[model samples]
Target: MLSIKVLGSGCANCKRLETRVRKVCADNDLDATIEKVTDYQDIMRWPILSTPGLVINETLVSQGRIPAEAEIARLLKS
Candidate 1:
């Protein structure tokens, strides 16, 4: 299973990113655990200097913007 974490402060973009991530996982039929890290401290711990970070299996993959569903699915598959 893939462990994915979205780090953000629960803003609109954050929520959108979360929703997109869930949809990507579901569409891809991926067994992933998607989590939202809303706490600032937790978000900061991931070495990302921007909001809406994506962490896959403890490896930080993206930050600052919402990645496309296809990209997310590719990441999850990898």
Candidate 2:
């Protein structure tokens, strides 16, 4: 199983990123637990300095933008 965290300030982009992540996971049949990190302190634990950050298994994968489904699937696989 994969642990994923979507970090944002509860904005539109954040929600969209979360939705895309879930959709990609479902499409690829990946078993992932998705969590939303809205608190600034919690989100700052990662090295990301942007909104809509993505953390996979405690490693920061992306930030500031929504990643493509293919990219997300690749991340899950690795």
The CA lDDT of each predicted structure is 0.90, 0.94
TM for every model, in the order presented, reads: 0.95, 0.96
Best-performing candidate as measured by TM-score: 2
Error of 2 at 78 (Å): 1.0
Model 2 superposed RMSD (Cα): 0.6
Candidate 2 structure quality by residue, lDDT tens digits, 1-78: 999999999999999999999999999888889999999999999998999999999999999999988998898899
Model 1, 16-71: lDDT tens per residue?
Answer: 99999999988878888889999997888889998889999999999999999889
Q: In lDDT terms, how accurate is model 2?
A: 0.94
Clashes of each: 0, 0
- Candidate 2 is scored at a TM of 0.96
What's model 2's lDDT at 45? 92
